[model samples]
Target: EVAVLANQTTFFGESGGQQGDAGVIKTENGAIIEITDTQKKLGALHVHLGKVTEGDVKVGDAAEFRVDHARRSSLRANHSATHLLHAVLRKHLGDHVTQKGSLVAADRLRFDISHPKAVTAEEAAVIEADVNSLIRENSEVTTRLMTPDEAIELGAMALFGEKYGDEVRVVSMGEPVANEHAYSLELCGGTHVKRTGDIGMFKIVSEGAVSSGVRRIEALTGADAANYMSARENVLATVAADLKAVPEDVPARVKALQEERRRLEREVSDLRKKLATAGSGATSGGDAFKEVNGVKLALRSLDGIPAKELKGMVDELREQMGSGIVALVSGDGGKASIVVGLTEDLKDKYSAVDLVRIGVEKLGGKGGGGRPDMAQGGGSDPSQADAALAAIEAHIAG
Candidate 1:
């Protein structure tokens, strides 16, 4: 890295939550040094950090310094918008709101402030609207060099942790609304637009909590704000087209579709339960239930049933048997789900948890847990579902 110190320069150093300037310095001997950043050293002296792209340079060489004007313009708009945002936040959220941090960049601006809770969407909209109102006013932005004490006396908001010299630059914008103080006045050293209208527009992209008692807001300005709105409108138009409705009716149509989907889900669930419990007779002599050791033991392996529905199916089957132990296994894809349930009268004689653990072990599962009356478990091997059922029957008979 090469650091160039010139007697006089126009590059703005990195300070006051704004990024450093980037440009190129060309020496008389055709040496091109690409300056990526400008910074301050020992509270003064702008240090241009870059690398030598071509040729060597010695002391006393005359060079031309050129800055990226487009980038600088964008940065100025965002920095000005940040000041308006700060003032509006203090007005709406009470005087307790103070700037904690910020970032003024070419793409967007981010401001961190002391806030107790998250800023709601409605509040963010209002804050954004207020800032844009000031921009629309096209108020002239003015700057003056004043003593720190005098700036503070004029209600200029000085940021904490910033080292201000004897004379600080104070930026003021918009007309005064109170006791001879402008709408926004702050001690800032960052580049900004000459008029608030130069910001063109303002749109808050997001707002969220950054830390304890602090919130951060990220926003876009100028062409970036316009592009953001256009993208949102396009998304809404696409969704409206798919739903066969206009954009104004999209929300109501979506709500109706959601209600219809929930109704269909309930109907499907009822049909599945009926299909699963079909032909399972209550008598002990049937294929579904067999009398073993003076207890009715029912074991069946089925398909296409979700693991979540297994316990409810087991409950219905146990209720049908009046007094018996019901064990059901349902396999889907490569996985197996098993549920073991006992009637209230037989709970003391047999633990559903122990019986289900035996079945789960056969299906390559480690542990199963539930109350003594009902238990559920699952495993990866569906091919071993029958083996799992047989293991449970064996444990009950043993």
Candidate 2:
């Protein structure tokens, strides 16, 4: 980094939450130095920081200093908008609101204030409207140099913990308020627009908590605000077209579609439950059941049934079997799920958890958990689902 000190300059140093000016300085010998930032040193001098892009610049050389006018203009608008925002917030959120911190840049402005709770959307809208109203009024912005005491006596707000000299610069904007003072008045040294109208427009982009008792609000002004609104309108238009409705009717259309989707889901779930409970008879000439050691055992493998519905299916199958052990396995997308249940009379002789664990281990799963009468488990391998059920049958037979 390079620092250039001049006897006199036009660049504004970084201070008061506003970024410094950035530009170039050209020497008489054509040496170019691109200044990326300007800051204060020892509380007085302006230090221009950058790298020498061209020929070397020596001491006592005459150079032309230039500040980027476009960037400076953007900064001015954003800084001025912060003042208006501060005043409007205090008006709507009570007098306890004071600026805690801030960041004023070319693209946006963030103002941190002492607020205990989140600023509601309704309150933010009102604050934004009040600021824009004042901008539309095109009030003149005035600055005066006076003693700090005199400025305070005139109702100008000073930032806490900021060191101010005997002489301070006071900025005021908008029409007079109930206190017979300007609507917004503060001790500020940052650059700003000549009139409120120069801000063009104001739009609040976000508001959230920054700290325990502080909230931060970010906003845009002028061309940036216009562009932000334009992008949002385009998004709204696209969504409306996709929904086959006008922009004004999009919300209602979406709500109706959501209700219809939920209703269809309920109907589909009921149909699935009915299909799983069908053909549950143990001795209806099907190979679903066998007498192992005088204990009737029913083992069936199902398809496309979700694991969550397995417990209910097991309950229905156990009731139909009358007095036997029932084990069911359902496979979907290469995953295996197993549920084991026993009749109340047989639960004391055989544990459902032990049977399910035996089946789960065969399917590459670790353990199974539930009450002794009923248990559920799953595994990653579905191709071994039949083998897993066969293993359970062998265990019951022993």
Candidate 3:
């Protein structure tokens, strides 16, 4: 059974890679139930699913739900604050506060709001302060169902691709006067608390991007802000206890730790590069053990060679080894790999892909293709590696 999409508030865990909002719904009889997950389907409306009902419940049962109080409060703290951030942007960065996407989870809220240039730290601080003041004032937030034309007349912003019926919900924040100049008015179906005051505190945690065209931000609200601060305090306490130093000195200790980590990362990266260069092969011609048609060929087991890189190596080897072809098969346990390289003169005479198929078949397994110039294949059989190589060489010789 399905319910009206309008009644069920969905989460922003939608297109932006943000997690769904976790909350709860209240029934008509005052049943407070947990809202574990919220999702959207085909841009209709957010769907809310929760705990199973005890008695048999029908699809059309009339119910009124509130967001999980704590989580929804946190979300409101972040969501409303994001609006202030937009206002501040217009003040400082011009009229480019288009929201790309947003996530208002209980722990933290992320906003992918846009601007041409990066917002300076000073500007960010001003925006944060503006939002904090709004939270401090505890502004009232109210929603009403209005005709689409009426909503636009009231200056409500609607998103593109958001399908609307004859009527839409317009959420307004600030004094409840019939035509008061409110802070924000938008068409949304997500769960939000009744008042801005419900949001305890707000902080802009970080700002970044969703894509090249879209800027992004993350903020903390309500209990999440408190929890984040508390967690940092606990860390500071632990550090002070361990070092026998004041909590204020933890900053110096953290800077030193960060420097050490950077040093280790640089060292590891350099070592990896050196090893890759050292172990990779550049072996030239030594002897041609077999001649296929008029082409000279050699066979051997190759190690530490991935298929892509080996093609270049095979080219150099082919020039020196002979004018024909050189194919190598490497295998360990049940897995086997093969690479074949050929010269331009031999394209019509042989196909590298064909060679791979024959090689895998000879090894009692399966494989596939590539161009006549270079090809690679794999199969299940380590024992088949050497035997398959030898069979291909012999076939060429005959």
Please list all clashing residue pairs in model 3, or write none if there are none: 10-46, 23-35, 24-35, 24-68
Query: Candidate 1 residues 243-282, lDDT tens each?
Result: 9899999999999999999999889878877755664432
lDDT values for all models: 0.89, 0.90, 0.65
What ordering of candidates by lDDT runs from best to worst?
Answer: 2, 1, 3
State which candidate, 1 or 2, has the greater lDDT.
2
TM-scores for all predictions = 0.91, 0.82, 0.52
Candidate 3 lDDT (Cα, whole model)?
0.65
> Higher-lDDT candidate among 1 and 3?
1
Poorest 10 consecutive residues of model 1 by lDDT? 279-288
Candidate 1: which pairs clash?
Answer: none
Candidate number of the best TM-score: 1
Could you give candidate 3's per-residue lDDT for residues 1-398 as a string of tens digits? 22223454434433333345665455555554465766667665676656744333445566655545555555556666555555455556666566667665657777776676666788888887777776777777778998998998887777656678888888777543355557677776554556777777777777765677677777787777778778978988998888777898877877888999999967765554333223232221334335656667656555444445445556656767557687776654456778887888889977888877888886666767788778887877656666777666666656
Backbone collisions counted per model: 0, 0, 4
Deviating ranges (above 4 Å) for candidate 3: 1-72, 82-220, 225-294, 332-334, 364-367
TM for candidate 3 is 0.52
Q: Kindly give the stretch of ten consecutive residues in candidate 3 with the minimal lDDT sum.
A: 276-285
Regions of model 2 farther than 4 Å from truth: 279-379, 382-398
